[model samples]
Target: MAAIPKSTGMQGGAMAEEAADELTLLAERHLVQPWPMSGSIGAEARGRIEGGEGIYVTDAAGRRLIDGPAGMWCVNAGHRRRELAEVMAAQAMELSYNSPWYTTNAPAALLSGRLAGHAPDGLDHVFYTTGGSSAVETALRFMQFANNVKGRGEKKLIVSRQGAYHGSTYLSASLNGRPRDQDWMDGAGEQVVKLTCPNPFRRPEGVAAVAFCDYLVAEFKDVIETVGAERIGAFVAEPVMASGGVIVPPDGYLRRIRELCRQNDILFIADEVVTAFGRLGHVFASQEVFGLDPDMITFAKGVTSGYFPLGGVMIAGRLLEELRRSNHSEAMFAHGLTYSSHPVGCAVALKNLDLLEDGLLEHARSISGHFQSSLKALEELPLVGEVRGMGLMACVECVADRVSNNPLTLDLEVGKRIDNHCQELGLLVRPLINMCVMSPPLTISTSQIDDMAAILRRGIELTMDDLVREGLWRG
Candidate 1:
């Protein structure tokens, strides 16, 4: 990977001039920003953030914008954490990197133990990775290892839901079900199965929540019968699907799916890359919020609060015991990342966790009511088809015809327009096609949330005005 360019954090004349030109030059020569590389090269890179403090970031031009999506849903502790920065520097100076293969580092071991203590009782072991993608890839590979060692080589298919964004790695991305995630990209199609997303808004229009959940469960049962349970290895899902526009599953859906996995002898992998680490007001949302006891739980993002690239999987004690008891003797799960168990990353994560547990978790919980209520009020907009979320993660979806769920001419670019307006109105928005998703820093205050919501309302109103002038929307 290219070295990360250090921010100058300048807002003045000469410094700003250098920063602006450097931003474009960096975009021109290097830095393929994810998802937007589809456009022309050096296409005016927007929002060159120079610095961040609390819930707001200062652009190169010194405009402070409310960080609406918490730096791609990672900066749970918010940005510019002095303590976390100090930890990174101190650990780097003491012990930079030790291979996870042969040598064990103190920071990594301590982080593993600390994380285990935070997780459920049986998830006692930890495997570190560079980010959420690698963490998921590690878990999926572990499942494959387990199935093969047990003499069930045919049980290799992974089941994932539509509209779920697992990761960007080849194997992890294969499990992604979001729109455009796999359009021109190749995935391990033969090894994966896709399922319908349990999104209430996208479910059959009038289907009740309970009935919708039952239907989802029945679909899984039917699929298993068709494929023969022995051929399926593990079922992976996000408790509340992030990046698929924060598509929260129906009530009773997650637990029911967990039950199905148990009955079918399939390992359930909970992908909590977003919900974990106080995003949902908890260290982990698996058993606490969803009542799920997954066979494996993969986490990243909030773990290091976006300070360092770090992620890991919590291994269930039962899975290890099962491997130990399997007949394939001396089998080895030979997989390790160069950055796995990285000392500096681990040390930063430990301090990040301290900040989270200190007061941010409870603060997230306290502010959730205001966060949800403020955004939910946007449902009154003519263009807003629905507004849904839990905790700090939420989405505002727009539609030309709410009944049909049609984007009309707006299609995907609707999100871009609202984003532009929001940026101008002193807030940054994570635009998902026609949907605006927000997962601000857990440290965000109620007043900041109100500010975010107000900017969002104005942004939507601006979009409405544009559509009316264009003669596209009746509003």
Candidate 2:
């Protein structure tokens, strides 16, 4: 590997401007950003975020904006946490890295015990990975491997849901159900089955919320029957579909689905990559918030509060026991990551857990209601179709009108317009086509929540006015 570049100490005014310009030029020339359009594939200069503190980040131009999506829904303890940084430095100095293939580290061993205490019952063992994608990939692969070892190799089909976002790796991305995600990408479609997104706001024309829940459950039943449960290995779902516009499922939907999976002997995998680690005011929301007893749970993002890349799969102890007693007990699972149980990442995570247990988790729980209600009020806006969320995560979806709740055309880019206006007004927004997702740091105060809501309100109003003036939308 090439030697790391030394910082040049560029600070203030012209120096900052010149540094920002050079960075942008370098990115445009050589950087390949995630989820770029084909038109600007390798030559895209997006925004430049220079520094972050607490619930805000400073742009390259020195403008501080509220971190709306909490750095992609991580940063539970917020940015620039001295303790987390200190822990990483101390651990690196003490023992930077250790191979998981043979040697085990202290931090990793300790974190596993702490996490198991917080995880649901039966989920007592963990398999560490590099991040959410790899975590999910590991879970699916484990399911396949376990079944193959048990003489059920045909049970390899994976079931997922619409509007779910798992990861970017080949197998994990294959499980993604978003419309635009697979437009230009090829996946293992034959190995996966998708169910309807249980979004109450977008339920069928005449179905009520209760009926919608039943419909979703019934559909899963039909899928199991039609596909034959013997061929299905696992059913993967997010507790709250994070990137799918924060789509919260209908009441009792997840529980019913869980029951079906249990009855059919299919492994239920809760992909809590975004919801875990205090985002929903819990270390694990499966049993705490959703009443789920999944066979495996995949998590990342907030594990190290985005300070380090770390993720893991919480597996049921009984499952491992079953494997141990099987005839193929001598066979290897044959999967591992170089950074698995990384000493520095685990050290950071241990400290991050300390912060959460001390007070951050309780703080998140206390303010979640206010955060949710504040954004829920945005439904009154003419451009906002609906504002739905749970805990501190929410989405403001813009539509053509209230009567139909139909999305605006792609050309409008309503969400992006709102985000631009919000940025100008000193707030950042995660624009998802026609929706603005807000998931600020868990440390956000009630006063800051008010300011964020006010800015978002004004941003929508401005966008609505722009649309009306442009004759693209009539309100």
Candidate 3:
């Protein structure tokens, strides 16, 4: 493995200079950034990626790595599509900014209309935002406003699931069940109640499939009752768990949850930040995979394939009508940002969606079966306890004891070792609490898929060999 260096490492002269300037600017702004790379890796890393095309990112070091994680699970349309760039450039030249409330722009209106055709029925009204977190906040606030408009002013509590991640804004962050993210907040826990993640692999002993569903329903019902069903606002969940180890729920889980929410008169908010577009072999994972018809659906990332920052909440007809009736300029829901529905972002998103509809959506669905089958091969490795996920999103969970099914906690180090080895082998993956996750660009070809599988297999094999050498494995 090539040793990562310390300080500004040398590469191409021009690229190094550009990287140095970027590093200096970052230091000046005190943008040390969250999710920093490990020290040796961070300090010596090339500070800039000059260009990207298709499924590859070319860093200042002139090194190219296949973007296995789709640039943080956003670039589904792949990188550097000239058509999207052209649309953005043209939109910027024409109308760079316009408020959606008063003067509307072509891109925003047209894109919203296009989105309406693709989203689940009744979810035709669109409210745009700058990114995923804002979209979640929009949904949260919209729920409150809708409840008040409908004469149920007391509904304020929200139900979320453990191991689910929404975003970084206050309400969205609160909805996230990761302990580390919740460590600093108090009001979030007070307002947001979390239920156990419906992970069959981690459920307690004697937890039958039917019983598990009942327990989940019971938990939500108890919370709604405690909060007062009329006062409980909405239940938010990711259709396919993304940040929390890519947990794909057992069958009937989502259907049961949707039914429970319906029975209790609680609005269901589908946080599809990671699963929307083509990531889950669906335009919307809620409809395509779970048959869930949510009152509000939030999305970002793949909408523009990470080309530009854009996200929004699609409101159901019932909510939209209520909002429209309650409109008084002074008393209307006035939550909005200056950059809300920025024309350039919308233009890029519009073009990107066109490309997705033209091919990527069907492309993802066609190849997902093969991808899952190839990924399951990792289950043969001794250290691997499980292989599970849907569409292009997947995870390989490591374990200390396979028969007992004891999950290997982060401190076990196997996950990090395997991840690092894979990076050395020219693959990039992020290890969740106890598993390594993969979400490649939908534009990647079969050859690239095979390459990804080979790289990951090598990492799994190496990890198992390391475990045996350390006397941690008997096989």
**For this target, which candidate reaches the highest lDDT against the unseen true structure?**
2
* Per-residue lDDT of model 2, residues 195-246, tens digit only: 9888888887898876898888889999999999999999999999999989
Better by lDDT, candidate 2 or 1: 2
TM-scores, one per candidate: 0.95, 0.97, 0.89
lDDT of each: 0.89, 0.91, 0.81
Candidate 2: give the clashing pairs: none
**Going through the candidates in order, what is the number of backbone clashes in each?**
0, 0, 1
The 10-residue segment with the lowest total lDDT in model 3:
38-47
Q: How accurate locally is residue 111 in candidate 3, as Cα lDDT from 0 to 100?
A: 87
Better of 1 and 3 by TM-score: 1
* CA-only RMSD, every prediction: 2.6, 2.2, 4.5
The TM-score, computed over Cα atoms with residue i paired to residue i, of candidate 2 is: 0.97
Candidate 3: residue 394 Cα off by (Å): 0.8
Which of the two candidates, 2 or 3, achieves a greater lDDT against the reference?
2
Tell me the deviation in Å of residue 101 in model 1: 0.9
Q: Per-residue alpha-carbon lDDT of model 3 for 62-129, expressed as tens digits?
A: 66767878888999988889998898889889998887667778888898899888898899988899
lDDT (0-100) at residue 68 of candidate 1? 96
Instruction: Assess the local accuracy of residue 260 in candidate 3 as a C-alpha lDDT between 0 and 100.
Output: 77
